[model samples]
Target chain A: MTLNASRQRLLGPDSLKPLNEGFEVIGAFNPGAVRVDKETVLLVRVAEKPLAVRSGFVGLPRVVSGGSVSVDWTPEVELDLRDKRVVRRKADGIARLTSLSHLRVFRRREGGSGWTPGPALLPETSAEEYGIEDPRITTIDGLHWITYVAVSRHGAATALASTTDFVAFERHGVIFPPENKDVVLFPRMIEGMHVALHRPTTRTDFCRPEIWLARSPDLLHWGQHQPILCGLNPWESERVGAGPPPIQVDEGWLVIYHGCGPSQGSEEVGAYCAGAALLDLNDPTRIVSRSVQPTMRPAVEFERNGFVPNVVFPTGLIDHGARLSVYYGAADTAVGLADLSRDELLSSLN
Target chain B: MTLNASRQRLLGPDSLKPLNEGFEVIGAFNPGAVRVDKETVLLVRVAEKPLAVRSGFVGLPRVVSGGSVSVDWTPEVELDLRDKRVVRRKADGIARLTSLSHLRVFRRREGGSGWTPGPALLPETSAEEYGIEDPRITTIDGLHWITYVAVSRHGAATALASTTDFVAFERHGVIFPPENKDVVLFPRMIEGMHVALHRPTTRTDFCRPEIWLARSPDLLHWGQHQPILCGLNPWESERVGAGPPPIQVDEGWLVIYHGCGPSQGSEEVGAYCAGAALLDLNDPTRIVSRSVQPTMRPAVEFERNGFVPNVVFPTGLIDHGARLSVYYGAADTAVGLADLSRDELLSSLN
Candidate 1:
């Protein structure tokens, strides 16, 4: 409720008109940001479903059915892809995801005319057998480091890759193992060590989902796993995952993340909101303060009706002198901007 | 320990020598008992694996593979069933029951020399696709009404049947739907309605495994599904299942059931223990008192080392004046008996 309901819309799924014409765009949100050469760059996660009207079958076109752009369902199969986030095939009674997601960049110079779409970065390695989604960028020295979720047969893993001019990228492979995702790296090195915050989802062995921190000299090799945040309140009883890269301030590094709780209806639906936490600048793992309640929730119509309902996912944020622009995914559909005072956010932290 | 550890052993696998000559009796425990014509009769659950062990193959024989005697694994295919209890097929990657379990009658007079083995109650209908296990008998008037767990392709359901002289049993088919087991019928109708306790294991929609109570106008039809007992303490966090039939007492129905918690090693290995509870005579769902602590845990060496590690599964209990004889499966391998005072059990229930 602290976030302003009235604000100008930023870059959304409609910005990529060329890609939207050829494909059925599901959502374009959760953009990872990095201010490169005075220009703000966003690596947005774009999801798409196959478009079929005349044919009585399920699958992507032959051109996009394999490799990096793989179709989850086979041809001549009656499958339900109603859930835009995932294309599920129920051949043997249980639904399994068969959709691929790729990252698309949106660049905007401080005072430039709106935003411009970059090339759609497809998966290159076998590790990304399914696809990559939800990129979080951290620029160290001169290189722009992007961490994203790589989904494959092995499992959902956090992958690392770097770029210089947003044109040429170097893949550093998977930094964190499977059954773990929602990784955000600290923009600057703390004590010459790269610190990261990630979420590990354990379905059987452990009962609850926990947020952990890991430090490494090299971005590819991570170690020293320690839990810094967890599901303490009923709002986050289900899970708490790290959001965008931490923002540096005079007090500390402020972080906004997403927390999910079980919905009153069915397991398919969940209540997702954005929460804030403050971490020490010298040691990113040391949590200084945290918000007992969520800063922004699903309060508007757009945030209540989409691929996933009741979701206000914060992915990118920018701070002005008096106002803060929190770029979030509204209901997992469109990109939204919420404004808050700089002092208000700093004071909200417990 | 509230119950004495020592007692004269009644019936184990040794009594079924004739059947043991050809078949392998893995476990002979969790017996359901009743007093008929001054003689105590037990419907025991006998689980058996394959006897042909010379080769490196695993399966069950034809005698125990079908009918009331059912084997979980199909013998035609080469499958790995090393887990003893479950048969896991690598094709679909699903685990099924490896050991075939069926109900067998073991009778003994008030002062008989030893226990004698009776007929093996073979599954006569298709509903008993897998096998019947863990029966609890309720004798109303002259008829002995028995309720047991029926496993089939449809799923594990609560089945109802009746017997008179332990020779002839009339199958009333399945009374409860799938995904439910551990059924125990009350001794008599409370205000003209038969009350029963059952456990239903939910897969996805619901999380916890809880024990439910239902009332029936007729034995064939049951309704009024309500959760009577659930996991309250950490020791019984995994699940709580109904064990022996609710014994009628002046205080209330003295109920002895089994509660399972995560083992010290892994979540796969659970420690099963016995606990007591008191229910209102008029309404079985209205719990009068429940024991905060377990009465009997997997303490003895016999109860610790069996087919399943650290399990003390109580299924049969006989009230003898001031003394109560508790028959339970020792370590999921054999039947072990313990004696407890009637006053001690009532005092244990809070």
Candidate 2:
């Protein structure tokens, strides 16, 4: 039941090899975890940047027009590079990621401690030109459907892909449009309709970013959107999003989500923490219970320092009978795992 | 054929009465025009602000939770009101519109010089809490479908409403998601499919705003999105969007669209001008011809000043056999009419 006592650092940037000889792995985190037979698979988000160095310039790697990776160089004087992960052009106030991300598979035996890396998933379309990040996997109709954020010139949109075998995959085009991310599909149909939890960011500041529920006859087109949750507590005052696919339980559908708020040390940067909420079994739009405070916070060294500091973003959850294992990205640099008793976690929510 | 010689200021804020006793109309422009039984109907967007004001505070009027108009007052010291139309909170950098908008119907009989005001359309749903602006009407079959931008905390989304007689309307919810606007539906079915031109804004600076094409079986659900036009010329270097429904002509479907570029006097604000393009009759996605330079610019005195400077946004185009009448919002403060020969406009496209 003691979360911090059972937590461990699982994987770091050094755990995976770079996609190409000219690239260097900068971060490996935010994995979409799922149990595949006897093995535990993690679709870890691998962020990479060009290894070559150029004086007084920053390089942005992206998938070019011909499906090849190219680096665009910009002068350091023209950019406001205050953030390590993003560089903003001073002229137009437009931002570009310093590194490109793609999902890489890592697996281990059910009871093994050592993990092994497998074949990687690279950016394939114009929508994924910048990169794809933060995937969540849910199984439905004997297929593992993966939902992730696709970043490009258009915007950060949620895209769907499915796989029966981890070796090969089929990509389903964008399910949610621009300014949307953090999509988690339920494992099964709810009342004969496919259900999903998505976070849509408003273009204007009239509303805060919050979690919304949507239903579809087919997974491609979604409608009947209902705003479900908003940031209420001080720890989650900024925004909230669905972390992983919800797990059905006796009480209700247990949802593990991420809540972001103002960091204690900075005004510009936000601190991301994990929280829990319970939705009604039949009607997921109705909230049964929610955690008043974050269930887990970024306290350890790995979660406090890296590409982005002071963050704990959970994107995967695995239920092992009485216990649950939560996998999260630590500081946008490494992967971290935490264990908790299912009953204790459910009881903690008010 | 000579644009400036045939242009005249049609209406201004002084033309319409305020919604209530304590409010004053600020801008009455951006009317969606259509021909109905020998009468030219204009759905004018009327923006209003609280007339009663106090020192050192600004009042923002909106439809509250209980479906009543209320004004939230904020201290002037805590806001940046450099822009006459929008006020940004200094604490969080969130911006809110200074005025609220609603669509009002205006009718002008054939051969008449004056327009008479008719029934008004008010915000009735949560999606339109902030307001509704810039409506484009297209008649197909027996009903006239009106597409407008619904602004709320959720973001600026395109909402569909249809009217049989303009006295009663049926709301069809949102057809496109957040960060999208400027939706113009085709008059009829295109190859057994309903076609539309929309402009979706990107969340990040990775891409410039451009016009896109989408098709639907029904008016409520839209899909098959394709990027059809982008800001290609210097006059349209910032963004471009479909202004009115494309008119079927001999060469192709004649499209009148709005394009924005850097203003000569200011870098912060852009100058909006109108341009023309030709799309294939069968395939609306193919660009047959386009105007290299803007066909119409903000040249007149009324178009160069007011709530928003340097704006001449065309929202309605009516074809009258050999001639066309263009109704545009000039400077976001008044309506302007421009008459052009159909043949001359088509020949102007490159």
The lDDT of model 1 is 0.70
- TM-scores, all models, native as reference: 0.50, 0.92
lDDT for B336 (candidate 2): 91
Clashes of 2: 0
| Residue B264 CA displacement from its true place in model 2, Å | 5.1
Minimum summed lDDT over a 10-residue window in model 1 chain B is located at B62-71
Give the winner by TM-score.
2
Stretches > 4 Å off in candidate 1: A1-350, B5-8, B18-22, B54-56, B60-83
Interface RMSD of 1: 22.5
Candidate 1 collision pairs? A72-A98, B68-B122, B68-B123
Which structure among the candidates has the greatest lDDT? 2
Q: Over the stretch A173-258, how does candidate 1's per-residue lDDT look in tens digits?
A: 66654456788888777887777887755322123466777666666555445567776676776778888778888889888888
